[model samples]
Target: MKLCVIPARGGSKRIPRKNIKEFCGQPIIAYSIQAARKTGLFDHIVVSTDDDEIAEIARSYGAETPFRRPAEISDDHTGTNAVVKHAILWFQENGTPVDLVCCIYATAPFVQEDYLQLGHDKLIQSDKSFAFSVTSFPFPIQRALKITQNGGLSAFYPEFRSTRSQDLEDAYHDAGQFYWGSAKAFLQEHELFSNQSLPILLPRHLVQDIDTPEDWIRAEYMYKAIHSSI
Candidate 1:
């Protein structure tokens, strides 16, 4: 069985109630739920959250809230793997064993059904533990710099200071949109960045991390720009 679990806790530090915060017009979490629904790839689409309001909102978007997330795993320190594992365990105990699971972030407003479908197809055909969204870094990370004690800049890779940009290998980072994994992978909490994973590359324009107020504003502008063109 295929299951989609979206982890959205109530305690948000950067932007209060960010999970349900309005992006454009509707709540940001709504975008994720809508994308998951559009894919038509899950036996059950569950929103694993601790907040009552969040659960209600999730239900309105056509996701199941089978059980309230335990308080222990709903804190700031808790990771996405733990939350997905908890949901997997709950389904198993309730006699609903899932073979594949997808964890979509609540704040990922840029998530598209086509990419989610791509991740699903890739995971099903491969032995990888995960097939998650990733995007190439706009700037090469090899020439990165850091601030010194005296507030001066220094190259992180001094050896690559003179290297040509085209000569450097391209780098990519987690798009923070969605992750498709086998039930066993999530339960084992395997390293997502390891070789046992497949990456679904996305264009940089469609990816944005909305953690702070500034980030939210930037995301709003980006979202508007994309939708306007569409």
Candidate 2:
């Protein structure tokens, strides 16, 4: 069985009720659920959340909430891996053996079905443990600067200060949208950022991390701009 799990716990310190918060005219999670359904890629599309309202909204969007996430793993400090592993274990206990599992972020309003499909295809075709979305940094990370204790600017890499922007290697970050992993890899809690994973590169315009109020405002503007252009 192939499964898609979205871990949306209730305790979002940064943005209260963010999982169900409206974005672009609908609950943000609706976008993730819709994207998963549109791909027609999973045997089951489930939302692993402890919040009753979140579960209700998820089901309303055609996603199943068969089980409530445990309070221990639903806390703020809990990582996504634990939530996904718990979901996998639940299915295994119910006699449904999942082969491939994709964990889609509940806030990923920009997640595209094509990228989800590409991640699935690449994970299946390659020997990698996982495949997920990533996007290049707008600026070269090699010459990044930091503020000193006394408030003076200092170069993180003094040697790279002389390097031209074109000479620096490109850096990419996790797009925080979705992750496709084999059941074995997820169950083993394999690190997602290592070389064992394959990256599905997304355009910078399509990637946004909505973890703060400022980020939320920026994302809303970005979303509006992108949709307007289309």
Query: What's the true lDDT of residue 147 in model 2?
Result: 98
Candidate 2 wrongly placed segments (more than 4 Å): none
lDDT of 1 by residue, 43-153 (tens): 999999999999999999899999999999999999999999999999999998889999999999999999999999999999899999999999999999999999999
Cα-based TM-score, every candidate: 0.99, 0.99
Clashing pairs in 2: none
Q: List the global CA lDDT of all models.
A: 0.95, 0.95
lDDT of 1 at 37: 94
When summed lDDT is taken over every stretch of 10 residues in candidate 1, the lowest stretch is: 185-194
